[model samples]
Target chain A: MKTETKAVDIDRDKGDFAYPEVHVRDAGRGLSEKTIHYISDVKEDPDWVREFRLRGLKTFLEKPLPTHWASKDLEAIDFDKIRYYLSPGTGAKRSWEEVPDDIKRTFERLGIPEQERKFLAGVEAQFDSEAVYSNIKKAVGEQGVIFVGSTEGLKNHPEIFRKWFGKVIPIGDNKFSALNSAVFSGGSFIYVPPGVKVKHPLQAYFRINAESFGQFERTLIIADEGSEVTYMEGCTAPKFETVALHSAVVELVALKGAKLQYITVQNWSSNVFNLVTKRGLAHEDAEIKWIDCNIGSRLTMKYPGVVLKGRKSRGEVLSIALANNGQHQDTGAKMIHAADETTSNIISKSISIGTGRATYRGLVHVPKHLKHCKNNTECDALLINATSRTDTYPAITVRGTGNSVQHEASVSQVSAEQIFYMQQRGLTEAQAMSLSVNGFVNDLVRQFPMEYSVELKRLIELEMEGSVG
Target chain B: MNELRVENLHVAIGDQQIVRGLSLAVPRGEVHAVMGPNGSGKSTLAKVMAGHPDYHVTKGKITMDSEDLLALEPDDRARKGLFLAFQYPSEVPGVTIANFLRAALQSRLPEGEEMEATEYYAKLYEKMELLGMDRSFTSRAVNEGFSGGEKKRTEILQLAMLEPKYAVLDETDSGLDIDALKTVAHGVNSLRGSKIGILLITHYQRILNYIVPDHVHVMVQGRIVRSGGKELALELEERGYDWARAGADEPVLTR
Candidate 1:
């Protein structure tokens, strides 16, 4: 989580346009390179960042979206119609006090500050396309904890940012990553110095406000030897008739004996397409954990990956996603074992309501020379409506004779007797359905932070309400 | 107006009849016991009475205080005035008892009427105390990871809190130890008053030792063969149900 001031300076050309009335929120729309240039110019970004945006714009235009592995529904995305950027108040706020009240109220309603007070050591709140306020406890900062948004870190902390940027996840890894790296605006940058263990958690909140616009943020974290840090991100997008795009890239580095845990709860409205790339590199004796919960989206495609590069490294990914009508949640994990005695565990769970669908696509591979490496993968899905569908695709290739891999997958639905028991206890049909769905994904839900888990449950319940007759 | 009445009850599982030509009534403020051995349609009767969809009530009408219950859905029947404590409660994981009960109680409120938090907790605590439940029990999942005895006690706790006009304790004493039987009995006894009626269904009369019934009925196959006062349970316990099944060949007409 980043707590540095967001330098708020809007270019005179963009700032000269008066704050349009609320009625104009729905007036104008469309996607163009002008919109991209406008965003880069407004943020006063460096030349490299501007060039990155243009390159991403060119790639996005030339590349035909890969539809072979996704739903035909995703093909409905009209690239030319979506307004790619909308700056939140004139510019990003540099201090906590500089944030506007309306933006703060949204965070308050989402219980961001309360979460920071109760469970986290540091917190950052992002409104629209930029960070509005960021704060870290003095003690954490005193421990040489370098936490800031990716852009700020790139500008001020070159020694830390320059060495690792795009090294773990390169520009051409995927179309979305290229897009995110090119136009990325606001996400956390956390670097923990060697031999220092931070006992508390850090958090970042991402909220999307503009209709038909895209939010592309970049996040990077590097944990040095013998240190530990946990970072969490939560995002919410307003419900709109047209689809919004949220493409982000997150890169993590775990040095020898270091540990990093990244947690995310994405509850975007069903009108948003959430396609993101997140990966980590773990050196000798290090560990990285990914805990993610995906609740609402028109379609989501994310597979957080971990590459174990040195001896005795460990990694685990725990994910839970719930899909309802007009939604397709495609999510899983990737684990690569390159060093001896490395181990990884992956558990993914999903619930499909109405006619929604959930798919799990995962991979695990160990080279023949990587002796004594092990991996285990498990995927379980629960379907509520009879029309709901689930698919599991696991590709595990183990060449090493001493390596071991185990995989398990199951798909089931709620039984009539279970529903009857809940109803007989005085719950309505909808309440019974919600209880069962919540129970289905419980094991993974417990791994989330308390604040995030509560909000996740409420979102699941709200989505499960109208799916039953 | 204070009674659960069944008239010419006929229920079937698919095309085969399980409960045929049976009628029984228990007035409010009293505990009535119905004893039948296994495979005698005991559990099926309980399920059908609760409006479980698997069993079709081909020719029957159930009512609570002159209000038609057969027309209501299972949950609707519960909120309206009827409660069926299951023989095997479903294990609901990840749903704390507090939240589950809150949702149940919430359904009983008028539209747009929210429950007061303090009042809800105070009432819940009062019910838990009456049932000899620990405070931490409120946080545990509903019947998940619970012992047989704890599950039964939890059911009684629910009965106490919901305060239904009629409660069907289906084999509540089946899996309980003596101590659990006594505790569950105490909870049920505390709620037995003129405003409520109880129908205790079980395979054994040991539970009758703790919750002495005002009336006892002998059920065989699918029909109630006899009805008598509390002494009948002691007699049946001593002589066995085979005698009652044998007497079905003769008619003992006593008013």
Candidate 2:
């Protein structure tokens, strides 16, 4: 019931400011065996993890960028120019007071603490290569749910962490995944106990504060049998003159009869390249849903996927991407039906403003042996200017009898008459355009949580400003 | 000066002229009907008054009260107490009626000022009730998937909610049945007061039977050829538009 006027008060430049870096440890510039060894030595990683890092580095060095189907803008990235790791050299703090003063101010400016106090059951805030603060409500933690940094999860719960680490998205899955595996740090690791449903969402906030840096955070979430949980993550980076890189890998596992929803809202600076790999595995009668919103970034390449591995498993992805001037948002979803009677749905909406470009690349597969599997996919694009561009590529392979698949795609522009109609009702040009854009993605945005949905609408309005003359 | 006045308005779309040397005025507290045949430039006048970008006002002046309406943007003109209810309202997909009206009202407020949600919904519900609209209609997308009668009713609902000094309703009775026409006329009549003026544009005189105008003007070839009291509408309804076209060459008899 919040009024639209009140929501417009959100500061559009909240993510444009940066503070000086205060890191005690630095992995130095460039990606090499020496850099990986420095990161491993600093974290005091075990021999297995150190060897895993070496193998990931090897794969990263051998693989080539997937330029055949991706934008040639990928050729502009310089791996040797980025600082792979920079940490404040402090372990994840349990109290907000223990966080560094400058880091606390950063999260405070972003309104993280207030949000945690309001609705979040637990929160983990990451600045650069390490999590500065991590906490969970005592009442929720008493229910046997474990939420902690990935490093702590590796050290404290290796039995649960090691079994699924790199099992869903292996190091060689893609070039960016391989690069992330080589030097990943500071993402959330969560596990909901069997039959103990988490009542509230667990959130993680990632901030990259340094210049000429690369952030590679790896996240993993596993919902046990008959349990339900929702995890949300948000990311932002300060505007830097030089190019930065953000490559992340996220894996989700939903056990028998479990439901897990993962939501992400990332607003990076225009000077950053965002390349990420996210996928989930659903067991018998389990459900996995992904709600992703990508707003900024010079070039973003992401396609969150799901593998329906057990009978009657369900998967759904609802995505919203906005590409303003001088940016490209390349995003979509994937569904692989490996079991009988599995169902999946993918709905994606994108907006391209000015000369920005958006692309949707999707894949849905059902083998000949599978029976009665169904899949539905819809992708819609909105172009706000004459120069705006969008593209769609959907590959669906359904070979089995009685299996069905449906695909719908559309590309449309805001007509001049529509704007005039809105204007005659007392809306300015920019307000009219923003309202139209919000309406275009309204259904998908409703999938987000209440707070995030409001924030998303405000962000869309901010982007629409100055889009019309 | 206390009127929505157009002085020798000349309008065109690209190379073609639509409204040529048209002049009219509707004073506050009066309902004026402009009866015209198809392609007689009635809708063009409505569009020009609303500042539609496609229409260029080559030579003319549109004023509300003593202020120049042609000098402002469409949204600014609307905020300054001018409204245009289109014959074919655009279908803005996924934007519910409640949100659309809220945004429109919000734009009229000064910066940093917020609209009171309770008062807004109360007024909105009252207006919708006045227009014979269901309460559930607030959540539906504007004009999308709406029946012909429903669209006209929604237009009246908006006209009631955003109370302007002057309203130009173009073909509001075009796609309406007799019952819907009566309902829409009732809504319009309820809003007629000393503070508002109305200019109802239509092709037929059927709607005039329900909501009688104080004055009637017959238009031919983008110019008002005749003007009179309410009897003029009855005369036209009886004789048809051929009688108006026959007198296009004669000087206008303004009353």
TM-scores of all candidate predictions against the true structure: 0.82, 0.92
DockQ of candidate 1 against the true complex: 0.63
Error of 2 at B95 (Å): 0.9
Clashing pairs in 1: A6-A94
Please provide, for model 2 over B169-192, each residue's C-alpha lDDT reduced to its tens digit, 9 standing for 90 to 100.
Answer: 999999898989999999999999
Please report how far candidate 1 places residue B1 from its true position, in Å: 2.2
lDDT of 2 by residue, A42-111 (tens): 8788888888889999999999989998999999998888888876322122333323343334444444
lDDT of 1 by residue, A102-200 (tens): 334434544554433211111122233233223353557789988776667888787888799888888778777876765677777788999989887
Model 1 Cα lDDT, one tens digit per residue, B118-229: 9989999998998789989999988889999989988888888788888999999988888888889999988888988899999998999889999888888778877899
Model 1 chain B worst lDDT run, 10 consecutive residues: B246-255
lDDT of each: 0.78, 0.84
